[model samples]
Target: MPRAVLRARGALRRALPALLVYAGVRALGIAVLAVWGYWTGKSPHQLLSARWDSLWYARIAEDGYGYTLHLPGGKVHSDLAFFPLLPWLERGLSAVFPLSAGDAGLVVSAVSSLLAAWAVYLIGERLYGRRAGVALVALWAALPVGIVQSMAYSESLFTALAAWSLYAVLTGRWVWAGSFAALAGLTRPVGAAVVLAVWLGVLVALRQGKEHGERGEEAARPALPRMLLGAVLAPLGWLAYFAWVGVRTGGPTGYLDVQGGWGNGFDGGLAFGSFVAQRLFGPAFAAGLGLLVGVGLVLWLYAACVRQRQPLPLLGYAGAVLLLALTAKGYFGSKPRLMMPAFPLLLPLAVAAARARPVRAVLTVSTVVLVSAVYGAFWLNGSGPP
Candidate 1:
C-alpha cells in the first residue's frame, strides 16, 4: 500500500469514533425534531431551511443584494445586513446542482456543521485527549439551539471556519489560521473573535520568542512575517462587506445603520441590562430568574475555561464571542443561539465528562440531547430565530 494510503487509514481510524459520537448526537436531535413535527403537523425540513434568517439568506442567494423591505413601522430590512458568503455559497451550489437556493443553503449548513464538529473534535483531542474530544463534540451537539447547526443559518459555517482557524493557530499553522479567520469574517460578524484569537496567539508567541532569546535558548517563535500576513488578511472579509454596505447605502456607517435598522448594535449591554431589569419585576419573573441563571452559567463556564488554561486561541475566541453575544442589543431570545459557536467554553464540561464512567457520561449527554431537541422544536414552533 502507498504511504499516503496508510496516513489516510490512520486518520480515518482516529476520526471514526468522534464522527460516530457526532452522528449519534445529531441523529438524536433530528429524531426529536421529527417527532415534534409529527405531533404538531409541522415539517422539520421547512423549519430548518425556509424560516427566519434562512429566508433572508435564500432571497439574497437567489436575487443578490440591493433588496429591501420596508416594514409597517418604517424599518427597512435590507439584505445587506445579512452577510454575503452564505448566500454566495447557496447561489453557487444551486447553480451547479439540481437544487433550489433554499435547499442549497440547507446543504451548505448541514455539511458545514459536520465539518465544524470534526474541527471541534480535533481541537479537543489536541488539547486533552481523544476521549475529551469525543465528549466535547457530544456536548456541543447537545446545546439547546444546536438545531441551528442543521439550518440554513451561517452560524454553522462561521463556526466551522472559526474552529479550524483556532485549531490552526494552536498547531502553529499561521497562514492557515489567517485564511480561515478571513473566511470566518465573511461568514458572520462574530468572525472578529477568530481574528482576535489568531492575533492573540501570535502576540504570545512573539513574547515567548523574546524571552527565549534573552535566556540564550532556541526560540520556536512563530514566523513574524507569516503571522503578520495572517493578521492582515483576517479582517479583510468583514471590512470588505462593511465597505460595500457603506457604499451601497450612501452612509459612512452604513453597516452600522443596517444593523441598527434591525435593532441590533453594541450598546455596552445597556439594553440587555434594562431588559433583565424589566423582566425581573414584570409578569415574566421566573423567566427573568432563568435569564440571570443562564448569564451566570455562561460566566462560570468561561471562568472555568480560564482556570483550566486551555490555550490562548480558545480563551480569546470564547471571551470575544461571549462579550459580543451578551452586549449586543435586541434579540434577547436569540442570545443562546448566538453563543452556540463558543465551543471552547464547553472544554471544562468535556474534561469532566471524560473522567466519568462511560455509561454515566453517555446517560448525561443523552438526557441533554433529549432536552435540547424538545426545546429546539418548541422554539421553532413558536417565535423562532430572528
Candidate 2:
C-alpha cells in the first residue's frame, strides 16, 4: 500500500475499537426494539414512528399551542405540559421537507444524538485525553436506555445542547454558551442546570481573581455579568409558552391541570416515593430493588467525584441531572433512561481506564456491552419500566 494509505489505515485501526463498541451497543439496542415489535405483531416503523410522547410534540407543532381536553375533573392543558422548542423545530423542519411531524422529530433526534456523541468526545478529550474521550463516547452510546437515543424523543437533542453549552462555557465562549443554554431551556425544563453551573463557574473565577489582587487582563474580567445574563436567558422560552397558554385558557392554572390529567402534577416527591416503595416491596419487587441499586450506584459516583477532585461544573451538572430524574413523577421505571444525559459522571472512571492496558480496556468494554445488551433488550420489550 502507499505510505499515506497505510498511515490512514493505522489511524483507523487505532480508533476502531471505540467505534465498534459504540456501534455494537447501539445496534443491539435497535435490534432488540425491532425484534420485540415484530414478535408483538407491531410494525417496526410504527414502533419507531408512533406518536408516543411525540404525539404531544406533533400537536404543538401542527396546532401552534392551544389548550384542549375538557374533562369532568378539569381541562387538561398541554401547552404548559411540554416545552415549545422541540415541537417548533419539528414544525420548521417538516415545512421544508416532505416528512410527517413524527418523522421530522426522529430525524432531528438522530442528528442530535450523533452530535451529542461528538460533543462528548470533544469535552472528554479536553478534560482528560483521547482514550478517555473514546471510552466516554462508547459508554454513552451503550447505555441500557439506548433506544431513547434513536426514538423521536428530546433526550438526545437536550443532551447535545447541554454538552455543547458546557463546552462553550469551559472554553470561555460566554455568549455562545448562553445562547445554547437559552435554546436548551426551551427544549427542556432542566436547561436551568447548565445555566446555573456556568454562572457559578464564572463567579468562582472572579472571586479567585479578586482575592489574588492581580492587576492583569485576567483579573479585570467581565465574565460574571455575561454568565448571569446567560443564566437569565435559559428559562425565557418555557415561561413564554406557559404565559401564552395561560392567556388562551383564561386561567394561569390551566397548564398544571393538564399535567395532573396525566398523573404528573408537581405535588413533590413524597407521593412518588411512596409509589416506588410499594413497587419495591410488592410483586415487582425485583425491579424496585434494581432501581434502589441504581440509586446506590449514583451515590458511589458522587463519592468518586470527591476523590478525583472533578471540577464544580461537572459536579453541578451531574447533581442537577440526578435531582431532575429523582423528582419526576410517572414512568418510575424509566428513571435510568432519564438520567442518561448525565454521562459526564463517568469521566473520572474513563480517565482512569485510559491508563490501563489495552487488553484490560477491551475486557472492561466487553463487560459493559454484554450487560447493556441484555438490559437494553428487555427495556425495548416493555419488560422494564412503564
Question: Of the candidates shown, which would achieve the greatest TM-score relative to the real structure?
Answer: 1
Clashes of each: 0, 1
Error of 2 at 114 (Å): 1.1
Local distance difference test scores for all models: 0.88, 0.73
Error of 2 at 146 (Å): 1.5
- For residues 1-386, what per-residue lDDT tens digits would candidate 2 score against the true structure? 79969954764455555555666677777776677677787555655555467777878888876645555665444555777778888999999999988889889887888767767776787788789988888878877777778777788899998888887777766767778777887887677677676776666566667877766336446665675676666556556656766786688876565567666644556666787698798998987787678778877887787677766777787788878777768656667777888877888778877888989986987788667766665665563331
Stretches > 4 Å off in candidate 2: 1-24, 70-79, 216-229, 249-257, 265-268, 383-386
Q: Write the per-residue lDDT of candidate 1 for residues 124-180, one digit (tens) a residue.
A: 988999999999998998898888888889999999999989988988778889999
Candidate 1 residue 86 C-alpha distance from true site, Å = 0.6
TM-score (all chains, Cα) for each model: 0.95, 0.85
Top candidate on lDDT is 1
